[model samples]
Target: MLKDVPRSTSFGHSSSVGTMELIRPRASKSNAIRIRRSGFQDFRRVGRRENDPRYYRFTLKRSGRIDISVQNREFGGFLGFPTPTLKVRLERSNGKVLNRRTVRGGEFGFISRRLDRNTTYYIRISSSGESVPYRLGLRTRGGAELFR
Candidate 1:
């Protein structure tokens, strides 16, 4: 099953295959080099809008449950900076919530069950009045994986 994640239009294209790197302005210079050396197609800076939380919307191809995972790239790198508390909210397209919790220091996972196949679900990620760079991934029970 192929997962469909709605790409950000902030990159100026509707359909471009690339990885997103949401980093702070101070870290931008080095992060850009790292991202380029890593061979990611492109990198877009999120966490710009102060009040607006970044939303990654994706549709699960099969019915069952999806395992969601989030990682903070800035918190843990060669510098070993302290990790920030990240909040993740999983909700359906209709505003119905599936799960909401705070994660820190470790990988966070949640299983959303009884979802309709091809229906869109949203993963809302934000920090408390701070900009955080993160990577979110999803995997269904049937073995489909979606990463960003």
Candidate 2:
């Protein structure tokens, strides 16, 4: 299955794709690296606008397709990169890197492996040989939240 997640409603064209492996990561220095609505907001009214710097939040379930769209945000390496890349690594809670892979075309897929429920996950993205980590606060998702 293929997943395409567009940030809010910026540009219908801006989107990231991932296969069953789910290794899709896109960073845009132009738009600031983010988790894309992966935060818990209890109060978001019409008057409230999503202007605060956000991170790219990917929520993967037991079985489903996850789409990562870079909408409303610009793709990283926009400075002078012709083709962009996304590097992903799963870091353990103790700060160990595991399952490292290079993903081209800003899209990735996951076949047999799915994210461990309520486990701490760390991700990094690099394009054009440049490296960047996910936002500091929003790095931990789901399981990490429950543990906290």
Candidate 3:
């Protein structure tokens, strides 16, 4: 049975797309919704860059699942920048960690277990001192769709 989920949320220097309110009420089988955000450079303060982390919050309105992955597109010091690095964490809204992993270079994948309905989850993405442009993708059993 489908249930109502909360849509109101607060974002800290981040953008959301696709299932903006997380997962929508599943009327019928559909393609996997994808949300993407680019974090090339964080803001700078007092002549120093702030190491603030990016956040993506979503709710599972049903027994749906998603595969989370990230990729660093910057490479070869093309712009005289260091190799891209990424660190991602998936956790419950209450601070219970579900998955945590780091990718020194290239793409990193983390598949989530079947999520319970009415539960809220968060995906946090942060970079080391060396920052570069990166992309985050979420896929599900239903085909594949991308959202800016």
Candidate 4:
């Protein structure tokens, strides 16, 4: 028999796809989801009211390189609608954008930067037109040592 898990207790719960894990966290004030060190790839819908800009945050355990990618999930368009363009931005905790890219449906946008340890960073995703689903990926390389 399966047991029911309380929604409040579902923090850190994840499902896997290949080497990526899908993280689902409770919505916060900024709706920012925290990305773990192992990294995560999440599927989300954006551009509609209330969810126009999706936010994600992560802090480096140590100095390392971070790579972020975003792509439209509805390839070749869903139903008869054309695929919506996606805008992905990498920003500092203070809201300064480090990089930005506009990616069409079925294409990928990526940004890579060397980040400092214990510093917070944010990824912002939005749609150019109608609301659409998208996949956002975050990966970290190098700097295995954790700060004391």
Error of 2 at 31 (Å): 17
Residue runs of model 4 more than 4 Å from their true location after superposition: 1-29, 77-82, 144-148
- Provide the global lDDT of candidate 3 against the true structure: 0.53
Best by lDDT: 4
What's the lDDT for candidate 2? 0.34
RMSD of 4: 12.1
Model 1 residue runs over 4 Å out of place are 1-51, 74-83, 105-114, 143-148
lDDT per residue for candidate 4 within 1-148, as digits (tens), equals 2334434225676643333333344343276877875558899888754376778888777887888888787578668777779888888888888999998888888898888887777888888857778888887777632232
TM-score for each of the candidates: 0.52, 0.31, 0.55, 0.70
Screening candidate 3 with a backbone cut-off below 3 angstroms (N, C-alpha, C), the clashing residue pairs are none
Residue 55 deviation, candidate 1, in Å?
1.1
Q: For model 1, which pairs clash?
A: none
lDDT of 1 by residue, 7-112 (tens): 6587687875566544323322112221111112221223444323656666645556566666645445337666556677877778788888776644554544
> What overall lDDT, based on C-alpha atoms, would model 4 receive against the true structure?
0.75
Error of 2 at 80 (Å): 14
- Sorting all predicted structures by TM-score, with the top scorer first, yields 4, 3, 1, 2
Better of 3 and 4 by lDDT: 4
**Model 4 alpha-carbon miss at residue 64, Å:** 0.7
In terms of TM-score, the best-performing candidate is 4
Model 3 residue runs over 4 Å out of place are 1-51, 77-84, 142-148
